[model samples]
Target chain A: MTEADEENGPDSGHDEIRSLVKGAFRGQQEDRVDVLAGVQAKIYDRSGGKFFSDGWSTSRTPPISTYLVTSWVMLLILAALYCVLAPISGEPKRVPTYPAPVRVIPATQ
Target chain B: MMRGLSVTVTEADDERRFLRRLQARDEHAFNELVQLYEGRVYRLVLRILGKPDEAEDMAQDVFVAVFRSVDKFRGDSKLSTWIYKIAINLCKNRGRYWSRRPSEAAEDLGDVEEKGWLEEGPARTTAELSAPDQHVQGYQVEEIVRRCIQELGPDYRDVVVLRDVEELRYEEIVEITGLPEGTVKSRLHRGRALLKARVSRLLGEKIE
Candidate 1:
């Protein structure tokens, strides 16, 4: 260990370094992050997605056409399933599409 | 021989598993790896480049590269070890690019000026700045440490920071630096001595 290190334990050394690093980070955050973000944004534009664009890219994936399509498909399937599995209100009976023939009209004629 | 082969296989398996998780885009695993080594990578880049912004960019770049090429990870050794190797190579490339950069020094000078940072001028006497209060002296010690580190040769500085400041194990240092063990040890020793002298100078200790 250096004489300075001997005077100060490794922990102190670490503390000092950590403070400097924190200061650096603070400086970066305050002054440079916008520029950095812009650069990263440009990179994203060029690459067609953000860095780490796979599943890990963003906290939440942005809404896209595919997302809407998937949601619609899922909703349709779910609605169909609900219709099929839900309890019926009454006994199942086919409603007549055409009225029982109006033979009364023919008898009057 | 069989044990050695098995060891290699085990290392490879671990790497393969990590890469597989990465391929599945595992953020937790990625963050785990970053948490494991970001300090070492940051210190390495900072010491090598002598610029914080560049170091941050490089650090991010290293991970981005890892993410891009995760599929190609052969997993012959430990994951950390392999990542360090790639980081060092990237640092070297960055170093080479920097050495060829004609405008970087001027740009850095501008950066310092814009930040209103003042360098220690030779005309200013240290005694004039020393305060009567003892608490200030403690703060001065930390500044001394920073300046002492800034003065060491890059090779020595890097190893010193990696070993003493970052506290990385010798084997990891070797894997990251691609230096032989003896070279690493020698660099650390020399670095410590140089650092000691500089700090002693800061403290006004006589060389006796």
Candidate 2:
């Protein structure tokens, strides 16, 4: 294969690049340090215990049960509101008056 | 095919359980997560950033990001893919900052070779003999290529690193980068070409 075609393609079956890429990272300091503490500390400190709080607020996503309960509560409130206000609020209080005052023929037909 | 499907389902279920624990702030689960992906995360950032110290910091930030945004992940993709996405975004953000201060960018690493691709065999250049380990010629070439990859623009750099260095598939790259499959392929093609040309030039230089 031509040298140009070696690393020219995305999936080119050339070992040069595969090996060279591997070699590039040789002798680099490995990331073996346990940063779990740092990560946890950052999460706790940055958000002021909003996350990783080890308590009620620990969950980044509240459970689905929370949503269901909230919806049910809201529906109950709406139902109670409708029952209490339905009779008092309807058709916006019709004004007691007779029919419109009839006007004589003013058509310019 | 049936087996693969079953395996995928099992994997998904396992991830869901793990994600639950993580989202719930299970310290043990989170610690397990660090143990699981920290090496890959560190290596990826090291390839992208070209510095071990920076990679360490970036990897920590990546995990922190994953922890902070676990709820945002909708299980539309694999957890590892999501983590890769976060790591890449952090890398790009830091890359942009470095680009703003060009002096501290890849040029600071070493002489980035110009684009040169030839049909002939490449000569082993000084760039290939200047790595930390002079005993291994591959390491020297590796160092030069690493620097060249860093020298590439962020758009091309991420694609090249993902495809070539990380050896990720195009589909995973699309999911991680949020680019169209065609865009990812085209960028990979272009990125690989750039990398080849750069390596060609560096490998052609005489040992000084």
True contacts kept of 1: 0.00
Tens digits of per-residue lDDT for model 2, B1-208: 9999999889889999999998887766887898798888888888888787888888889998988788788888888999999999999899778767846543443243333222233433333555544434554566677787888887888887787667788889999999997778677666666776777666774221
Please give the DockQ score of every candidate, comma-separated. 0.08, 0.18
Tens-place lDDT digits, model 1, residues B53-151: 887788777766666677677655567666766776787687667668875453332343354333333212223344444324444444455555655
Report chain A TM-scores, every model. Answer: 0.27, 0.37
Local accuracy by lDDT, each model? 0.58, 0.73
lDDT of 1 at B159: 76
User: What is the DockQ score, from 0 to 1, of model 1?
Assistant: 0.08
**After superposing candidate 1, which stretches have Cα over 4 Å from the reference?**
A1-56, A60-109, B1-16, B23-40, B43-51, B102-135, B206-208
Interface RMSD of each: 8.7, 6.0
The regions of model 2 sitting more than 4 angstroms off are A1-9, A13-15, A26-31, A50-109, B1-4, B106-136, B205-208
Return the DockQ of model 2.
0.18
